[model samples]
Target: MTTTLHCHMPLPANFRADGFLDFHRRDAQQVAERVYEQTLEKGLLWHGQPALLRIALQPQQAEASLLLDGASRRDDEALLASTVRHMLGLTQPVEAFEAVVAGHPQLGPLLARQSGLRVPQTSSGFEALAWAIIGQQISVAAAVSIRRRFIQAAGRRHSSGLYCLPDADCAAGMDEASLRAAGFTQGKAQTLLRLAAIVASGELPLAAWQFAPDAAQIGKQLAAIRGIGPWTISYALLRGFAWLDGSLHGDVAVRRNLQRLLARDDKLEAAEVEAWLAPFSPWRALVAAHLWAMQSSDGY
Candidate 1:
């Protein structure tokens, strides 16, 4: 049986769905798509039943409409609503970040250009961490292609023709040969397997760590894992845990974007970038998001 539910979520003054979705559509192989003029996720579920959710937003509007295609019970509706809020970053206030940006000379113009951008969240922590592993030292296009192959090999199929990202258990159970066949390098495959094992064994406790007070401490813990360095952990915190305070100084793209934004001829070291970002403390992740958005606008 199929059911439908609708919910309205209030948005901050500067929320822009198009800018966020544009950032999301960068992954050409993403399971979600622009469907029927709305952003759609095919395999989202409510109470163990397959559900499809469409997020419809109007620029500058005060609220967004969330339409769920297979939700029945009130609990299912609540779950779906929470998921939508988190995925779209709807709960974050943004006023403080905006006030800070307005006082900056360079960032002010960038902010004006991309007024309502939000950091897009990954579907799950496992998916976020796995993508971080797969994307290390590779072009975004190549990473997306590799990720598509990996998901097809290990992920669960739904009737809607979309695949759910592999959970820790599914990824942990994948053999090395299968991962290699999915275009993973031997070293990368080994690292991924190790990470999956850690997660599946319940050692990392990623969900609980998301609510932890100290992000730097969590980054340290994740860094101790093989193949997870500062960059990977920071990216995971930003994308998976919705950590606004995380800095992406170690990210190559972020560094390049920063240099370009500042019109600097030389590359800035990670320390230099962090120093420059000191004023944006607690909202450094949003600054990184804007840097990424600037790159996207420039067609990079």
Candidate 2:
């Protein structure tokens, strides 16, 4: 039986719609919509079950309405709400991060302009891991194109005509050849399939971390997998489990933006970037998000 539920969540303080609006526009999973308010629609899995999530953002009111359609259990209402909150970064401690950056020479002004911005999370850890793998050393546009093809190949269509990102089991069933055909490099294809198998077999336990995050432990576990590195693990933790401390210095955009922020003429080394972000600890990912926003925001 189909079930529908509605939930309302308060937006973060000084919430800017630009990040969410840009994300909604760029996301391959979502249907495009724009009017007085913006709406993002996508198919996702809840406890291995399919459902469609529609989130409407009203920037003027600084609030959002989340609707879940096709849920199998009315009991899932709370869990569904929590998931939506996590996906949209509703629970991000933006104030805390801002406080940490307040009055800073370089970051202060940037944070002022980007007050309510947050990094939108992936629907699942597997999706985050898969995306990190697919995105390694590639431009965002290339990664998006490959991701679209990958979703078409491995994901299932929902009643809403949107494809839900493949769950671990479904992803595990994907062949490397199919992934290669979908534009994944040989290493990336192998790595993704291996990760899916590990997760599907319950060996990796990606879901457990979301509830009780142990970043070091999870990082060690993911690092054991071939082709998974510091950046991949950090990215997955930030996007999947909402573990905000992971260092993203290795990200090209983060470094480039940091260089621009500092008005440096020379390229920065990865170690330098890592050292620069260390002071922000526990909010490193948030800082990285700000750096990303700085690159995206025009007239900055």
Candidate 3:
């Protein structure tokens, strides 16, 4: 079913799929051709359902029928339209995105590269928190493998290829035996299930969090969780909120990129990179995006 709809949102500035989605979304391997978000709720929200991409956006015509399905299959026309509008960034002012990337040199280039950086805010913070734990001290490939296993076991696949990650109820009963098959270490598996238990019991409000926190506050809250910490929160900021200024203080890649960009050795201190990147305030997320994007393309 195709329905013509008008888009009130501008095309986002930071819209691209340079393998980041490979790690971020479950349907990535077979269905990553169309995924995006607005910058309002942070980049935490993502479009993982195949229904989201079914109706190809007719850019030249700017008019076409939307093929809505997936997690949103049951939604009415109004809701579908709203979701489309939001997805295409028609709801928010493009000006806000401009303001975010206007001044900073690093982010300016990145914003330019990202095409349109509009991502809606609708992330499962707990899922991302779990992801961080699963990924710690592991290669992205290894992390993704482990994650795929865990998600497959717990999450129910929705239409259009979106997997609404399991909530506390589904996760509470997940024992170490099941997770070990998913290739998780016993310790890692225990931490994840325990985290899910707390969430299911309402002891931890993993899904409910705000984006406008001071660094310390964000760090503190995430660290309080058994499996989350500074690096995890920063990651959540990137994957969950999609902050333009979000950068991990000690990320190895961030340091290496900064050093290489500065003609320094590959071992630049995290502090130095932070100092150099501080000027791009509020847009560092975009800066990090650019750096990661660059690495994503040319291994430099």
Clashes of each: 0, 0, 29
- Which segments of candidate 3 are over 4 A away from where they belong? 1-123, 159-164, 206-219, 243-245, 297-300
User: Global CA lDDT of candidate 3, please?
Assistant: 0.52
Candidate 1 achieves a global lDDT of: 0.71
Residue 281, model 3, lDDT: 68
How does model 1 score by TM-score? 0.84
Candidate 3, 47: how far from true, in Å? 16
True-structure RMSD for candidate 2: 3.0
Cα lDDT of model 1 by residue, 29-110, tens digit: 5664434344645443333344455676654432333333343775656655665677677655566688778868899998
| Span of ten consecutive residues with least summed lDDT in model 3 | 38-47
The C-alpha RMSD of each candidate to the native structure, in angstroms, is 3.4, 3.0, 6.5
Clashing pairs in 2: none
Top candidate, metric TM-score: 2
Highest lDDT model number = 2
Residue-level lDDT of model 2, residues 198-273, one tens digit each, is 9999999987677557889999999999999999999989888888898988888899899999999999888999
Question: Model 2: how far is 164 from its true place, Å?
Answer: 1.3
Shift of residue 52 alpha carbon in model 2, Å: 1.1
Q: Which residues of candidate 2, in runs, are more than 4 Å off?
A: 27-37, 59-71, 297-300
